[model samples]
Target: MPGEQQNTSELTVEELLHDAAVDSTDIEVFLNALTRLAVHNLSHPGEELLCGITLLRQKKASTVASSSDRAQKLDEIQYDYADGPCLKAAREQVLVHVPDLQEDARWPEYRETVLEEGVRSILGVPIAIGSGNAAGLNLYSDEKGRFDEEAVESAQQYARQASRALSLAVRLARHRDTEADLQAALESRTTVALAIGIIMGQNRCSHEEAFDLLKSASSSRNIKLRELAADLVASADPSSAGAHFDR
Candidate 1:
């Protein structure tokens, strides 16, 4: 109803929550959906909205999704130059409104590049996830002064919507990453256990002594317990792993 959004504003919280639950397994898919939904709800004729979201990871920023290549290209320009409205919005946790790229002296290098590419205006609104991860939703236009007071005011509403969905997606991604790390730790512990068992059987040593031997070998060889265990397991023959451990 707002632009060409199919009345996304009318979507009940329950409905949004239900859809989010369905996408809990894939945060990228969920984040992309949120960007598309925001663009659809806020786009206008002269504005010709092309939207993208930049995600900050490990002190680096990358454009994760975009409604069009136009937005993606602009994101790259900002990233390559390492300074732009979008970066400020994400890093400073403030809204950055660039009325005209040609006249904006805030980021001289970025301004010249986008201005050459026919970009007239930009609005970067920070998407706060509340988890110390910075992100920004960027909207670009080809017409100067497209994002006036009323326009920005309306866009703020969509920014909040995108932020909510993206925040949940971020949490989902973190949960998935945490689960993977735990699984890896469990697997590594299991490998060490198996290695210890092999050492006990081969060396006729107590369980504690076997573990100590494994630790000694790990430290001596400058290898991880998992790597050493894998090597031992690889060298196992039908005869005995005793010879392997002796090495």
Candidate 2:
């Protein structure tokens, strides 16, 4: 099985990106699919394959995705103890391999807990995505010595593929978030403008005076200008404002 050349479909760089794009902003979906595909294509000798993508930001590491619930629980155990191969790989940006957790000496508590959970082998591959962010792909197996040199090498390649796709997904997710924020800002401005129109028509005031009056009202009520405008807009149009912006 080690030297067998299976003619599986080669995962191209473009295909990974396409998968990431298809998942939209769901990091869990993208990572779970990527890791499962990686394990299936590599044809490793293992009963089960599990993966977790960790995002390191603000000096904090969190498991963002996993291929299975067992994998997620194992990762959580490591996080609880602050010592495990996955957390180490993510925090230190290194490749971590444990051939047999029962005999491993690196993490005493973690090794004991994982062995009880029927996890015998693990591989952690660092995934760097875009700027100011890094993640790790964690693989778990039920068989001991499952992740040998060849498996590790194959996992590295998959991690590279995942990195490319995850980088794009991260950027796209940020873009979507930014776009949403800008849309909300613009909508708030429009609502305020509409409220200003109402104020001008009712109080016979100029544009500047109307805005000042709105601000004064907002300050007096201890509410945001946008919130005051939204309220005013809701009062002006009983149907549109609540239907569109209340969310």
Candidate 3:
């Protein structure tokens, strides 16, 4: 009963991500915070010197979203050589911690290549979103056996924060796109209305006839209706009665 109760209390990474309840501002803060945490955590004596975050696309695990040269190079190494902890963790959706590269033979090519770069240890943790595949947070250390279980757990917590932030960002981006489209539509309609009014005054025509005139002018001049409307508005003058019919 006690074991089952403890298991029930333990929350999965997905649950933790939802608990964060990310907003647009929170998304920015979360990303900045995660990067800061990674920097600080790696700054710990003997911890891996993190290059940057490398996001593994769910549709293609080999594809990576790396912001820097170092991270891109690391992703290339993992993909080309095929034996790094980052690759393993992302593929398996689990933590891969290598205490020392000198003695670790799990990935011979990777070990040789990474050690040549002055890295002695690596700790990779999977970054998952929802119920899908995972990406990786690859941490490199100059010292042997740098990340312990506690450090890995801390990294996992940060990954959870990142997931929530990403979800919120995507949602906000869609909303912004929709809002922009709607505003553009409204502005276009206003321009058309203004043009119609201008044509009515100038041609001494009905509203329907004015709109038809505006459309004919637009089609003849090969100008956007909105631009034509704006031009008509610019030509009209309030003080001169002839200004309305001038154009």
Candidate 4:
């Protein structure tokens, strides 16, 4: 209803991307929406285009989202060979365009496989999201020369416009991950403390002595300290063994 009066084509790139980010509930959902948007907005009329997004974080590249299953499979082929236009664009932060895969000689093995998949032209545009992280927008077309100069420029511009929303999504995901990690740490500490308290009650020993006993048992059993603590707590009181935090 928000765009009922105005056609989607009339929407500015910023508005489109902002709507995508706001509509999504998580990073994965937003990326999927972005790939779908790319295929819809960037593709020429009557031209079939498959879009995929490759994200590079901490020097690792992964296909984060795709407009279709075929696009996802195409992106995975690049990962299998460890060299492809998308990966190259993301790593070098440059655009890589293969107007005709058959004529391209850069990635011999990669080109062969991609050609077999019926992709004739490929365009990879790097998304500039600052902070040591990189991403690339990959477009696959069955028609050779599908991504001509004008099309390439359009794709590049789309990537530039999409970067801001993507950066915010990545930051939100990282924050969620950090919070989850902290919660897990607190739960583990609580479990260990409860286990130590049980040990103290059973042996009538000091807190340090109880902790040493727990550590010695954990080492002897070749089990992690956390696991050992969990087991001890469970054995002592099944109902109260579950990790509980005040927050």
Candidate 5:
């Protein structure tokens, strides 16, 4: 879009996504479709497309794309070192790219790292998450002067799609984790409650006092209340008496 003339392309991205299945397994399909479009620009005169999204981890960079290994490594280095384009993009929620890493001294550490890896140019675009933190995409090139203004615009268009895909993936994963946690918490609470009840009967104490006793025992002995409950349940009868439970 920025470097190439806008009148030429035939297929719109919406049409492509509409055609492709928008499921977990089909995400790669979307990525492939977008990249194919960018590749087309690259082949024609004055056009190039390099795009990629980071994996959905760390909460900060879920759907963003990068052009090369150099760019990804730059992101990791930024994460570890606490400085770089990825951090800037995440913080600002904007698109960023360096057409010539050697020429830009804004981030010397990143520049040096990519230079060492033989990368000359790079781009990063934010993946949105309905007004929240999402992943980012980075595009890189081995040759300098590969990404001009028009190319960056095309990459940005593709990045929008990547962002949506990333958001879907991350939210789904988070939901699954939340559901699992809720289930486990419910079961654990049942165990703890049962154990508390057993302690109340054994000690002839009220519910509040039973809870206090359990807390005191757990703290002093440094054993988890859940495990203590399980042991109490497992032992049953008189055999449970004075069973030394190590923390």
Candidate 6:
């Protein structure tokens, strides 16, 4: 009904995701907003549709976002069994439709479980994120044959429009993660260097000797190098109570 009343097409996927990302603090929150928008725009009058997004990166599958708790649970059921329509669609980069779960013989165990959840119809559309990543847009409905040919086409088209935005989001998330990792590495290196300097001052040893001493202490104590370095720095400089590598 919402899709019928308004021109949902007026809002491009890129714009939708951009708004979501701007309002969200992280990728997970942005993805959650994306699923909610998909459900709102795709559901018809009196037709309760549940939506979920499954992301597979480096061969690991995870339910990244869902429209509701029920949708999240349904996606988890598929992950628990490690075989379901969404996984199939994502892995093969294709659309999978189950008009009637009771009649669909594929994934018998999953079918039984989803049927118990009152989901009679399902649709899974692949989302092309990147080479090492795969994703799927999963839709569930209580009425059998809810996703007819027309509905299937709409879902497919939505997936195509959203895939580019999803890819960009994933890349931005990776970039953020890389930046955080690099910052952490730099902080850790700085702390360790400070610790080495302290060791050299205390023992009047060379830089290499101080490093060897720190390494030996870390090995003997069975503590992480960074943690030991942080502790040493903290002890030497009481003013620096909380070192960068404390975390």
Top TM-score prediction, candidate number = 6
Residue 167 lDDT in model 6? 80
lDDT of candidate 5 at residue 153, scale 0 to 100: 74
lDDT tens digits, residues 185-221, model 2? 8999999999888777667778988888888888887
Q: Candidate 5, after superposition: displacement of residue 46 in Å?
A: 18
Off by over 4 Å in 4: 1-26, 238-247
Kindly report which residue pairs in candidate 2 clash with one another.
none
TM-score of 2: 0.85
Which residue ranges in model 5 land beyond 4 Å of their true spot? 1-72, 200-213, 237-247
Q: What TM-score would you give candidate 1 relative to the actual structure?
A: 0.83
TM-score of each: 0.83, 0.85, 0.55, 0.84, 0.66, 0.89
TM-score of predicted structure 3 = 0.55
* Alpha carbon deviation, residue 40, candidate 2 (Å): 2.3
Residue 38 error, candidate 1, Å:
2.0
Give a tens-digit lDDT track for model 1, residues 1-247: 4564635544653257447745668776666666676776677744468788889867689998888777788899998999899888988889999998888778887888888888899999887867778788888988889889987986776666666667777777888899999999998888888888888888888899888898889899999889999787767675744444553
Q: By summed lDDT, which 10 consecutive residues of candidate 1 come out lowest?
A: 6-15
**How much is the lDDT of residue 75 in candidate 6?**
96
Q: After aligning candidate 2 to the native by TM-score, how far in Å is the CA of 128 from where it should be? A: 2.0
Total backbone collisions, model 3 = 3
The alpha-carbon lDDT assigned to residue 38 of candidate 5 equals 45
Compose the digit string of candidate 5's lDDT tens values, residues 34-130: 4455455443455444445554344544333344444345556666656566556655668878878889988787678768877788776666755
TM-score between candidate 6 and the true structure: 0.89
Task: State how far residue 240 of model 6 sits from its true place (Å).
Answer: 14
Error of 1 at 30 (Å): 2.1
